[model samples]
Target: MRLNKTQYVALHLLMIFTFPSYPPYLIVAYYKPELVACSIPSAFQGQAQIKWSKAMITVNVLTIIPYALTALIIRSRKTSSFSRRLFRSLLLVMIFDVGSWLAAVSFIKLL
Candidate 1:
């Protein structure tokens, strides 16, 4: 099944709004332990900060690029079985993406 232009536009809009912005925030929370009230010993904090920053940057780039590409593909006029499958996969990914962020945020708040 192929989506109409309006559906395409709507999907892209939804994706733009729903994509995760948590990796950067996670990076901050991990590095600035004060933000999340982490009580780690001072000796390892510097190493932890470096590791978190690197991991966050890597994951953020990885997640964001595919997200942008998926949005672009959804917006295009090309309709094929592959595109449909890709669109469904993207939708599922977005669902998981949003769910994961919400879960993490709640978990952090509870900590």
Candidate 2:
């Protein structure tokens, strides 16, 4: 389905905030678990906690790239249909994610 400019912008807004929004809350709750604070429950315990923490930290740090790219796409003079824009944005993020993942693994293996 084709979307107009408004829908295209909305798509960008949603994409920027979707998965990237989760880490902030998890970070807050994990760090500041009080009666008034949010709790992350016992599911994230022991080694699981460590792995999850690392993944969360990595995700939060890496999310900035896509956010910047989306903002650029939104503000760019070049106009494209919603599906094409969405596909390009998603493809860019996916390529970045995979490349970074491989790089991290390779770096870790060397160490």
Candidate 3:
């Protein structure tokens, strides 16, 4: 199903909320225990608010296209080779990278 601009907007907003795989925060939490406080890490200087927005913007801008494709593939009825190829690749990532499991489910739910 082709998404019109409004659908695309909705999809993107949904994706933005879902796509920031937990690894980054987890790493910071586990490895940098000192930074565990909600306060911004001094090294990451400047306001916490801007940093959060930047991370969200960076993740969505970089990943939205591939993620959209993944969602489309999951939602599609066809069993095309391209879909198999793309999904298989994603499955491989999902297999190797534990962090991606949530993303895989989120994409599936986009249908």
lDDT of each: 0.60, 0.62, 0.55
Off by over 4 Å in 2: 32-97, 100-111
Q: Point out the higher-scoring one by lDDT: 1 or 3.
A: 1
lDDT of 3 by residue, 1-111 (tens): 999999999998987676555435544543532443342233232354345545644654555567667767677867778877887787666445544544643454353
Consecutive 10-residue window with the lowest summed lDDT within model 2: 34-43
lDDT of 2 by residue, 1-111 (tens): 999999999998997788666555554545634343133333343454455557755765676677667657766845568755785777677768867765764554355
Q: Kindly list the per-residue Cα lDDT of model 1 for residues 1-111, writing each as its tens digit.
A: 999999999998986665445444444555643433543222124455455445544655566677778667667866777877877887777668866765664565366
- Pairs that collide in candidate 2 are none
TM-score of model 3 relative to the true fold?
Answer: 0.28
By descending TM-score, how would the candidates be arranged?
1, 2, 3
Residue 28, candidate 2: C-alpha displacement in angstroms: 2.0
Off by over 4 Å in 1: 1-54, 94-102
Cα-based TM-score, every candidate: 0.37, 0.32, 0.28
What is the Å distance of residue 86 in model 3 from its true position? 3.7
Where is model 1 poorest over a 10-residue stretch in terms of lDDT?
A: 35-44
